[model samples]
Target: MSKGPIAVIVLSHRDSEQVTRLIHRITEGTNSFAVIHHDPSGEPLSIPPSSQVAVIPDPIPCKWGRLSLVQAQWKTLQWVARNVPEFSWALLVSGQDYPIRKMSAIEQELAGSPYDAYLRYFRVGPDPAEDVIPWQALTRRRYLYKRRVPFSRRSVTLPFKRRHPYRNGVELYVGDMWFNLSAPTVAAVLDARQMSERMLSYLRFAPIPDETFIASMTLNVHPAPNVAHDSKRYIKWGRRQLHPQIITAEHLPDLRASDAFFARKIDRLAHPEIPDLLDRLAEERTASSG
Candidate 1:
């Protein structure tokens, strides 16, 4: 089957080596494009030849893990949209993510399909208490009880002046942040800056703008039929924690049954099964296609 060019945008803080390795694996036998957004303060490293690496200027004095990282990701996406022509779909992979399916299988599944897989859930009018606030507040406590931490003292806040109260009986659904977006969706997000000053203004204060912004905009602009409500990425939440628990060999059964295109929070140092798992998944995809 013929395939349109796919753009893989890797979001990383200091893991250039890991990102490079993933790019190598992804482009092994296909005409794929890759862009790495290396945080300015990350360790110095060389990007392999034939790949595009954009390093954010150092000393930007931005938090490595918060909304700043999301901003960096948006910038990288904008760059890809402008520089890479004929790009059909954009895959947003983190430094810690590993593919559980072969690129061939993924391409075949997505061939000529306009739907993009992203984590989406339904929420009633009374949005979840946490969702209303920016992500930084929930994750980093950037804004707590009207007081800001030293690092977040001057940080921009989300547009919501006051937190919306959620009624006790209302149900809320929240899920993963990672997503695979179509070119048009990507373009729409990039264009959000131009269309809505309110959104662009909210970027600074909206702690985890990355998670909320795209999902909110997509829900508002795109038709419901075009959006993949659930992204096929395997993620396990830790004990009362926000981030997904690390993936280990013990989770292999669930991963296999997940029908997920990728899995995250892999322990590269401790979990040696990762590479083996990827290999097995690739073989499975090959056999299925043949």
Candidate 2:
């Protein structure tokens, strides 16, 4: 198979026990392995010393909806690009994410495909950021200038605004933070990001830079036709909510119906049965296909 062992990058902060379990579960089969970047502000991870998953020795401090999160992910990707160069495809996901489809199925899909990356990329340029894409309104709010209030963690969107910043004034793209990319494509993006001085500066104050950084860099360097516009993740956004709704057993029907390989925002404390249900469904599907 052209696609060999999968490299999974896990960005986690809370729930040490669950995070360690997630690492073991993802790396248990198909020779896949995970490297984790745990935010220092949260509880320290407790992965076993003998575990297959690698931990970043000095993880960068991460803040929600800030450039720090993007930087953390970039550092993690840098490690994978250097160490796991033999990976067929690399998946960017959070520790809370759980696979809905069987690992074998995901590998088969990656091996037979020729796409450089799998992600959601929609242009946000040439005009104002209103209705430029399906998710334009929310996206515009994310890219606009903002300032953190003094003595508090809160930040407010400033009235001053300009187009998304780039050194070359090229069109920028925005999409989900999670992505799947081939080995070569991952290298290309890492290079592009390293060379982006202006964009990096702008992102230092931008809200949720991770959602926009990787997509813009990937689409700029890679041919659009060879890139799939889907991240293949099942995430449920709640009305007027800051984060995605927690996945539970009630979401099983939708998860089973979708072609998504993984689902997110799983709170193990609240929905202990969700993972078991996913395992059962994966086995049933594999059995039926066989």
Candidate 3:
């Protein structure tokens, strides 16, 4: 049976070159459409000619940790919905991320499944008690530095005062930022009324709004039988930290067992293991299919 088309959206700030490289690697032999959301960094971008690229106009005098990134994502989603025809699934990815599985295997698994792979939540609330430290809450604060406008202390206040989707006294769990979503779920997210307000509010104060927006919105609109509980991307958290540790070749065995389509936070310069990891995944996929 012929597999359906998949649209991969890669989000990045100033890493156009890395985004292009990832596009080349992941879409090498697949029927996939790629959209790269260039963060409003004031530099020229080198986009691949083979892939579709959308340069989101950076808002002048942009502030860090603002809603611009989320806006860019929304724009990219609209672009895909309008321009890309016949896509069955949409995979949200990052420029810093790489695929750990072969295209064929990912296609095979997705083709046979009706579910979307993403974290979901019904409500928003305080972050878990354990997640309040500098490592968890302050890592992305770098983005908030060097703002054109003076930082407002009030703006830094907590974004989620309460857990999301708080219906029937059930506290909803937030999903990961990265997700593989079905087309229908994507449509629902774009159409949701709370997307703009909640996302914008969350972006201002939340250390990582990307992790929560889709998860909460998806659950609120389309409660799953369709959503996948776990993200299929392999991420390794650093020692006593919230963010994924930088990935390297030594992680190949773990990647293989992860059953994940992609892995993140790859170090492009010093990581010699990337090529080997990709080759092994391709070989194993071929062997499995044969």
- Candidate with top lDDT is 2
> Per-residue lDDT tens digits of candidate 3, residues 109-155?
88888675555232333353546445333423322221222355233
Give Cα distance to truth, residue 15, candidate 1, Å: 4.1
TM-score ranking, high to low: 2, 1, 3
C-alpha root-mean-square deviation, each candidate: 5.7, 2.5, 5.6
lDDT of 2: 0.77
Better of 1 and 2 by lDDT: 2
lDDT per residue (tens digit) for residues 72-113 in model 1: 656666777887756777777777787787776666676666
- In angstroms, the error of model 3 at 230 is 1.4
Q: lDDT per model, in order? A: 0.59, 0.77, 0.62
Question: What TM-score goes with each of the models?
Answer: 0.77, 0.89, 0.75
Tens-digit lDDT track of model 2 for 208-245: 67888888878777444378989999999987787998
Error of 2 at 157 (Å): 5.1
